[model samples]
Target: MTLEDWGWSPFFAKQFRTWQSRGLIPARVIRGEKNYFRVWSENGELTVRFAGKIRHRADGRADLPVVGDWVAIESQPGRRGLIHALLERKSSFARNLPGRRKGKGRERIEQQVIAANVDLILIVCGLDRDYNLRRIERYLTLVSGSGAEALVVLNKADLCADPQYYQHEVEGIAGKSVVQLCMAKDPEQLDFLFDYLQPGKTLALLGSSGVGKSTILNGLLGEQRQKIGAVSDAVGKGRHTTTHRELFLLPLGGILMDNPGMRELHLWGEEEDLSESFTDIEELAIGCKFSDCAHKSEPGCAVRVSVENGNLSSSRLENYHKLKDELTNLHRRR
Candidate 1:
């Protein structure tokens, strides 16, 4: 496949010119480990290590190459290749390191890049008991901030009698984003997903365990490429099937990045995305009498009024306020 088929575009092309002039070749990082990466270049897949300069320049984990990153590489005669530097990302999905401790008072939060340069994020949610609207909102905020379009994929539809019922609930929260329903166990049910999976496009499968992410991955590949974990009948949660993030080329010409199901997604910055994800509340805020309406006991508060009128769910508003406060605290710490 050509570079363009691997999701390379003019945005990355312009930035890669400098590296090309330096006699380094451009390669897309397919998989990344602690210190090494598997990249797809003109000569095919190559095992590459970070150059000394790159290591010295990197400030943190985000500065290094992650899956779906394009980098400049120097090939040695017989030894492993060296990655010089990473090109600027068109979009990146990141979050605060889960369960990592944070220092108080002005200490910057530790963030980890989940995937870089993703074009779309398939927020897979199961129709089973594992489904939670709040969890979907958290994933939406993360993807919306990454500059990638979010598509809510409701998998395991067979488990639920009425998939449309769940679809409507997601649409209410998703706003402008599309919500798709499918049963990963039945490949025929997943045919509709190909409409969004075009050639050269990159999509990331994101959801919690037992949400059928791995099953969906294998479905798209038309084979048992990823191992599927068995779900517990009592708890309805699946074991950690995918242990790491990986990029797979689809038979239909799209690139798919399958990530390990996150137990908790602690959001970082991207307050604007938070506003976008909750446009319903934002629309109501515009009609508020005060420019800065807290929506608590404020006079002529459209948001609270909507909540009272049954037009908006109070839980959604509570989550919005909670996330807004979290971001506000982050900004103050910064």
Candidate 2:
């Protein structure tokens, strides 16, 4: 397959020109293991590890190459190579990695780039107890500023008698994103998802544990490529079946990255990311008398007025405040 089939485009080609003279080839990182990464170059697929300079040049883990990244590799004789540099990503999503609790307010925070060069993100949410509107908002916020479109895929329709009810709830908070319900085990119901897949495009699946992500991935692939784990009937939660992040090229087209279930999603982004996820609140704040009103107790506060007028839910406003506070605190730490 050509590099275009692997989601390469002019964005990467422009960056690769300088490396071409050095005999370095452009490769797309598909899967990452403990110490190395699996990448597909023009010659063929090869196992590769980044050069020491790559790590030394990186400011943080987010700068390191992750799944779905396009890198310039220095190939060896064998089916292996060394990654000398990471090409600039067209789009990437990251989260705050949990760090040691050094102290109360002095806790260390680090950025963890989950995937790079993605075109779309499937925010999978199960209709069972795994469904939570606030959690979905958090996921949307994480996707904001990543330069990729978001789709809220609510799976396990059979488990919830009123799956549409959950869909409606998600749509209320999903700004500029469409919500779809489906039974992941039933491949027939997943046909609409194919419209989003195409050559030179990449998508990622993100959600908490036990959201039927593996089931959905398998349905799209039309095979059992990734293993699925059982959910605890008592806890109504899912097991961390997918342990690592890997990208798969679809039989038809497009690339899909599967990430491990996240137990906690510590955000790592600017407060502006909230504007996309919390558009409703952001729009309402536009009418506020003050430009920098926090909507807590500010006079002529449009957001708080919406909550009082039943235009917005108080819980949603509270979540907006919570997420805003988290980002503000993160900026302070950084």
Strongest candidate by lDDT: 2
Q: Which residue pairs overlap in candidate 1's backbone? A: none
* Root-mean-square deviation of Cα positions for candidate 1 versus the true structure, in angstroms: 2.0
lDDT of 1 by residue, 153-233 (tens): 998888899999999999999978999988889987888888888888999998888899988889889999898899889
- Write the residue-wise lDDT of candidate 2 on 1-334 in tens digits: 8999999898889999999999999999999999999999998999999899989998988889999999999999889999999888888888898667656654578888887889999999888889888999998998996878899999989999988888888988997899999898898898989899999789899998888888878888989999999998999888898999988888879888888998888888999999999888889999999999999998999999999999999999999999999999999989
RMSD of each: 2.0, 1.5
What's the lDDT for all of these models?
0.87, 0.90
**Residue pairs clashing, model 2:** 210-238
TM-score for each predicted model, relative to the true structure: 0.95, 0.97
lDDT of 1: 0.87
How much is the lDDT of residue 254 in candidate 2? 88
Worst 10 residues of 2 by lDDT: 98-107
